[model samples]
Target: MTAYRDSGAPPAADTAGTRRPTVVVITDLIVLAKHLRLLDAAERRGVTPLFVFGPETPADELARHRRDPRHPLSRLADEGLRHVADTSLETLLRAVAPWLRERPVRAVLNVGEVFVEAAGVLAQTLGLPGPGAHAARVCRNKPLQRLAAPALAPRWTLLDPARTTAAGIRDAFSAFPAVLKPASRMSSSGVRAVAGPDDIPPLLPDYGLEELLLLEERIAGREFSVETLVRDGAVLWAGITAKDTNESGTSFFTETGHTSPAPDLTPAQEKLLLDANTEFLRAVRFGTGMSHAEFRLTAEDRVVLMEAAARPPGDAITRLWRLATGMDLDAALLDLALGTEPPTAPPRRRARQVYLDHPRGHLTDVTAEDVPVHWVAEQGRWPDLPPLAENAPARGHAVLVSRHRGDLLGELADSQGRSVSVVLDAPLGTGIDAAAHDATGRVTIHTAAPSPAATTEEPVG
Candidate 1:
């Protein structure tokens, strides 16, 4: 059962004497659950947000959301939620036509991965602030990103799965120990390392015939991502985040953890990374909103671009920044979407998020019941931890579990495989090593052996 019905009529809008300017938010259900705080900020700022869900919510899941009052669809019932048949620019423009007529749209914000292009096109068409169509196109397609900023990108070759044979792929690219990735997927969905020529054919069938793939030179270095807030083609604020991934001894490159204001960089390394990120953002012509650009610092002190995304990063990165610095990134992101100046504050703390992965089995329990936690999406029985003091030397932590009992767990092959996450807040001048260790010790994920007939599969949500 899906949560939405395909009604031709427009969603209910403000019937009050004065209508607030609407910020057309485009996203899917999964991402929507993670962005309730942004909605809260929007309301506080006196902005009306019209949500356009680009994907369907399964009936059972919708029922689950209805059961939890914290879900966005339920909590923001007054603000309209529209289910669009497709995410093309035309479809989105038509779906929001009625609301566009009723209230002025201040911005068209892309909140989910798939809606970036549509949101960009809509925002540009309406002359609003957003990652314009060019930035959206380059950000969405990895090949385009490589083309747009060749200097920042690693050496790579593009292959059309429909036309290129395994031999041709082998001939065109010989950077053994390379990474084969789909040009437009997110969360390392179709990203894997290839040892040599023999690895090409075996993986070809895994991708779509029409999909374009990249054979990129495997960059050996410390991986990091730069999160930047841009306006009018200039960077306002940028922070470096150190990344931990399972790719060290494995073929899959699933990110396991992230720490904000990367604590390991020297003065020179920090300048190089921030400079490279600025160059990449400029190359893509990113107009406004947040840009999460990833890079690798090679052993020889070179920065290589992994990829970039034109949306708030997944895995609570924005939240980590907010907790680490006094800045409210969610509120700032809303302000960017509304074409206003966001409040700024200096960093007074450090924060890290560590994803908990359990052995392959049926998830039986996640032990954090006694510890006070503030759930990011749905609430549990634990008492909520109060917000950390802004000006004091304070430490805080929160636990979030995305899986329930009896769900099957799998290898940490990608971002989706990790179920539980721990976030730690530390006072300024604290190192990431200590905070990360504390966070990892805060939660334990226990799993039980699956039935004899059970097959290896993705975890049930």
Candidate 2:
């Protein structure tokens, strides 16, 4: 269930003067949901934010779409964009390229980096948007991000993957518990938190993979992400957020939403972050769209830049901006991409997003009455939270969304607490194995949610 146009055609121009505010890259809920939040913000302000894309997917996908935590395509806006289904990205560029060439889409905001980089090329090719492919590479690569940080936020060290060693990694950060991460992968793809001499292996991938990783002195204090809009080397309308990261794996974001307007900082600290972000943006040279800038509110109260992506936060944190702060981060991002006025700066109150998760083992069952439920795909992705392709030991877990973080976490904890872990009676063996058509406990035990007090049952031999 994607927010797409079924025409099976690429995005092309429809009317002249019709502004292309911003084109979202990944239409998954996490990113696209921000667009919806912006649209919601705009409608309140009486301005119709416009961008071009495919039309709505089928109704069946609606449930699947809603079930996904990332985003639920606004059926209301579906009619706005022509539905072009079963299309490829290359086709999309081809269709969009020709039309935008004549009109010049004005500004292209890329929510997805791959698409953003691709879109950046298109904009550069059309001479309408941000930097070209050359700049896109520098903005995306980690080693580059590290090198560029000094110009923006903190001062850090870089390690070449090929020649770097464990001893070097330790020496690089002066033997401090350093942060190690892949220069290219997304989410918790290869990010790790290494404490001391012993915690290095997990952080360092030895066998095969890119060697380029940053040995950063893991900063202490609150971790927040700053969402920035860069226009030709300038950072404008920087919105900061206290990010919610997983307890153990620091890379993977378990849940996000936002606290409206973000906690205000001391005037001086705020200015410093603003200054750093501006410098970083200049170094990256992103002329349009959004970027996720990670920073640490250090014990010294200084903002330390962790990482910056040429895109928005992957999870639907923007949605929280809407509910908590009343800011249309998506729309603002769109305008930023199109070089327009701020859209996400609208007024918003308290906001937070949380997920219901199973702390351990297999999920015997999950049920949501009418609301919505979804699985956290490999590494806990929102929309496409598909289980490990096949019978891969259900390593990851599922996520359920709620309006507030407190409620979601509470429900998740409670639900997980009640969930039967192994349900030992049903191993993938004996007559019970693959008993797809059975109904009784032997070969036919069906799916059901047990009362919280239900007793553990044993199978008769």
Candidate 3:
């Protein structure tokens, strides 16, 4: 999210040209991907990002990076974030010694979910505004969320993964069909909802119950992820995104395309949301920086706050901000962290980000009937995929982009018809192989588990 804030604005023009302050994005792949646009803006303004990563991140999992000659930015992984527990503070700081000394990194951006503790430490030493230990302890801890949420976002309560017991589940089973989630988990990775206490034990091992937990009171509402760039008492550039998640709705990352300019909220509600965001940050003393927050609006007109992250939105929500508003959020984030006035006007563009999803089928052999299809695993550009994987699912998506909002879906659906589906020799589900439909087909297929108990969600807008 901080990445897109840069837009086309030249790098900090007010700073020293020879050795401009650097923005250190402490991250893995997604963090780096989020910064691509900022890199472009930085290139125009004359700034280089010193991105660092850890080795624990798989190369395959890290979105593909190409050494294209034409590209202005160069990303080099330093495998530091992954080893937070082992690396000493001085040793870690010394790793980026060159950039720290040369560029004198003025602002430190914390995008890594697992590195909040490390980030807070870094920010304190560097004199930056981020989720320091006190802040992180308050935000990430399940116990804290339970205590604070009722007043801040009255509809919600914390769900402690550690203390959530069978008795606790039984007592609340009638009124609240509790959703069990890890207190520290960023996404829906370990979030699950069981109707009764009986379902609790089976989930302990996978949910990592070894740690403290958050047994949040399940709020019946429409889910929405809010992204805000807070500077001083104002939310400089704020945007709301529709989040599509996995079956558990717990995927830390979104898996489907997000439409910008979220529908359904009345002008009053929108203002309340924006105002509540600023006020909440004010309570936290969130003076400056990007913050990602998720909420659910109930059937009763109650607005809820789920989790408030003290940084920019992740996934491609960064792109959504750029598309919805003309504001360059990355630059705004840099400015905010550097104590400079971040701009409120979003950049002008109809931007959209779509995650390619396949039905519940194992990957089979996939091949494009046309020449080949390019996949955007990240914000940057990629030439084309080599070929569909051996088990790539038959029903998949091809994210498309266009300025015509009304015709965007039509265009995508049309372009989808251009590609011919290849036949697969595998079975369905895990065995589902690669196969393409005829020239006439939709560009993408969204998958949801087939459950008799599953309920459909009404469009919030």
Residue 392 displacement (Å), model 1: 5.6
lDDT of 2 by residue, 115-202 (tens): 5455567667656655455556666676777665564444457666566666766665673666666666555455556666456554
Residue ranges of candidate 1 with Cα displaced over 4 Å: 1-15, 63-72, 162-166, 373-387, 390-396, 452-461
Candidate 3 Cα lDDT to native: 0.49
- Model 1, 1-461: lDDT tens digits are 13233455544545566677778788876676666666778789788777787654344554466567755556545336667666677777767777777777887878788889988888888899997889988899998988998898888998777776767867788787799999988889989998986787778888999888888999999999999888878888988998989997889999988888788789999999999999999898999989999999998999999999988888778778877776777678888878887977656677777786666888666666344444433332222333477545435366777666677778887787777777777766655566556556656666777775653433221
Estimated TM-score per prediction? Answer: 0.90, 0.61, 0.68
Question: Which structure among the candidates has the greatest lDDT?
Answer: 1
Best by TM-score: 1
- Cα lDDT computed for each candidate against the true fold: 0.76, 0.47, 0.49
The model with the greater TM-score, 2 or 3, is 3
TM-score of 1: 0.90
Clashing pairs in 1: 1-59
Assess the local accuracy of residue 416 in candidate 2 as a C-alpha lDDT between 0 and 100: 22
lDDT score of residue 227 within candidate 1 = 90
Specify the poorest-scoring 10-residue window by lDDT in model 1: 376-385
